[model samples]
Target: MDIKTAAAMHRLRLISLPEAVSFLLLLVCSVLKRTTDFDAVPVMGMVHGVLFVLYVLFWADAWNRTRWSPGRAAGYFVLSVLPTGGFFAERMLRRESEASVIAARARREGVVNA
Candidate 1:
């Protein structure tokens, strides 16, 4: 992958964990609002919303740059909605990026023709 694609994936990976955390916190806040006086859902909601938007934007950039198959792209999108999916996404992205780095190095060294 090129630098831009790598950067986009890296950025999306960075956002995923915080978004997941916000979602979890929102869930907790929802329960608290029902059982007690504490309520922070609105704040968490906005934060998650922003992060989700950023995730989508970065996802689109990565898809366009990498030309990933629709099925692969969908998998990334699905992760955004599920709890703890961001961690999975990060792990997957890390693997992909590492592979890409190795492939890029190979290409540069002419160990494998592109």
Candidate 2:
């Protein structure tokens, strides 16, 4: 992959994991507020909201640069809302980025005929 593609994917991967964590924590906090009368919901809500926005921005960047298929793009977009889906998105993207790096290295070193 080119530097721009690589950078975008890297940003997505970096933001996705934390965004997922925050989403999960938000869920927990909301549940606690409802069930246990805890007041941590607002703080966690704000954190998750910020993370979600960042995730969406990064995802859009990656989608544009990568030229992902409609299905792939939808998958990434849908992942933001599902609990634990961020982790899945991160894992999927990690694999993709790693493969891209490997391919770039191989191409640079002329390991495979172009």
Candidate 3:
């Protein structure tokens, strides 16, 4: 993978973890609001929003670098709105990164030294 692809993949991986955590916290805040009228919703919502935006940005960057198909790109984009979807995104990215590493290693092996 090129540097841009690598960077985008790395950022996407790191961002997804925090995004997932924020989503989980937002869910907890919603439940707490119902049970105790706590006001954590706004804070959690803002956090989730920021993280969601970051996820989208990174996802787009990676998709562009990797030239992902429409269906695959859409799947990643759509998952952000669903509860607990960030976890799925993280897992998917990790798998993609692993696959990229393997492919790059193969290419390196196939290249004959001058």
Candidate 4:
């Protein structure tokens, strides 16, 4: 992938974990709000909302830059909604990024065709 695409992927990957954590925390806060005096739902809701927006923006950018197929793009979007999906998304993105880097290096060194 090109630098812009790579950067977009990196951004998405970086936000993925935090977003997931925020989502989980939000859920916990929601539960606590009902069961106890603890009520962090509003704060955590805002945090997760912002992160989720960022993730969507970055995801769109990556999709545009990489020209990913519709199915692939949809898969990523679906992952963003699931409770533990961001972790998996992050892992997948990391592997994809590493593979791209390796391929880029090989191509640069004349070990593979562009």
Candidate 5:
């Protein structure tokens, strides 16, 4: 992949784990607020919200620059919402980046024009 696309994907990949953690923590905070006096929801909410926004921005950049198919794009979007989905997204993105590196190398070596 080109630098722009690579950077976009890298940003998304880096944020994935932290975003997931924040989301999970936010959920736990919600439960705690309801069942107990614990009230960290606002702080965790803000953190998760910022992370979620960054994730969406990075996702859009990657989608636009990489020209992922609709299904592929939807899969990535879906992964962002689930509790542990970021981990899966990270793995998927890693595989895609590895494949791109291999493809680029092959092209440099005069492989198929495709």
Candidate 6:
């Protein structure tokens, strides 16, 4: 993968955890708002919204750069919506990035042909 493609994946991976956390916190805040005087939903909602947008933007960039299949792109999009799915997405991205790096190195070393 090229640097831009790798960077796009990295951006998505970095945002994934924070987005997931915000989603979970927002759910908690929603519950608190319903049951108690504590109302953090507004703040959490804004945070989650921004993170989710960033995730989507980065996902699109990665998909464009990597030319991923429709199924793979849809899987990533589905993960963004599911609670705690960002963790899995992050793990999968990390593995993919590592594999790309290894492949690049192998190609550079003449051990593999591009």
lDDT of each: 0.87, 0.91, 0.87, 0.92, 0.93, 0.93
Which runs of model 2 end up more than 4 angstroms from their true locations? none
Tell how far residue 58 is off in model 5, in angstroms. 0.4
Candidate 2 lDDT by residue in tens digits, 1-114 = 889999999999899889889988888888888899787988998999999999999999999999999999999999888888899999999999988888889888889764
Q: Which stretches of candidate 1 lie over 4 Å from their true place?
A: none
Question: What pairs collide in candidate 6?
Answer: none
Candidate 3 yields a Cα-based lDDT of: 0.87
* Alpha-carbon shift of residue 25 in model 6 (angstroms): 0.4
Give the per-residue lDDT digits (tens) of candidate 1, residues 71-94: 999999999889888888888988
Per-residue C-alpha lDDT of model 3 across residues 1-114, encoded as one tens digit per residue: 887898898898889889888988899999999999687999899999998999999998989998999999898887777777778888998899898888888888895436
The number of the candidate with the highest TM-score is: 6
Pairs that collide, model 1: none
- Kindly give the stretch of ten consecutive residues in candidate 4 with the minimal lDDT sum: 105-114
Q: Model 6 residue 72 lDDT? A: 95
For all predicted structures, in order, the TM-scores are: 0.93, 0.92, 0.89, 0.94, 0.93, 0.96
lDDT of 1 at 57: 90
Clashes per prediction? 0, 0, 0, 0, 0, 0
Model 6 spans > 4 angstroms off:
none
| Candidate 1 least-lDDT 10 residues | 105-114
For candidate 2, give the lDDT. Answer: 0.91
Between candidates 2 and 4, name the one with more favorable TM-score: 4
What is the C-alpha lDDT profile of model 4 across 12-113, one tens digit per residue? 999999988998999899999999999899899999999999999999989898888999999999999998889999999999899999998988888955
Candidate 2 — number of clashing residue pairs? 0
**C-alpha positional error of residue 111 in candidate 6 after TM-score superposition, expressed in Å:** 1.1
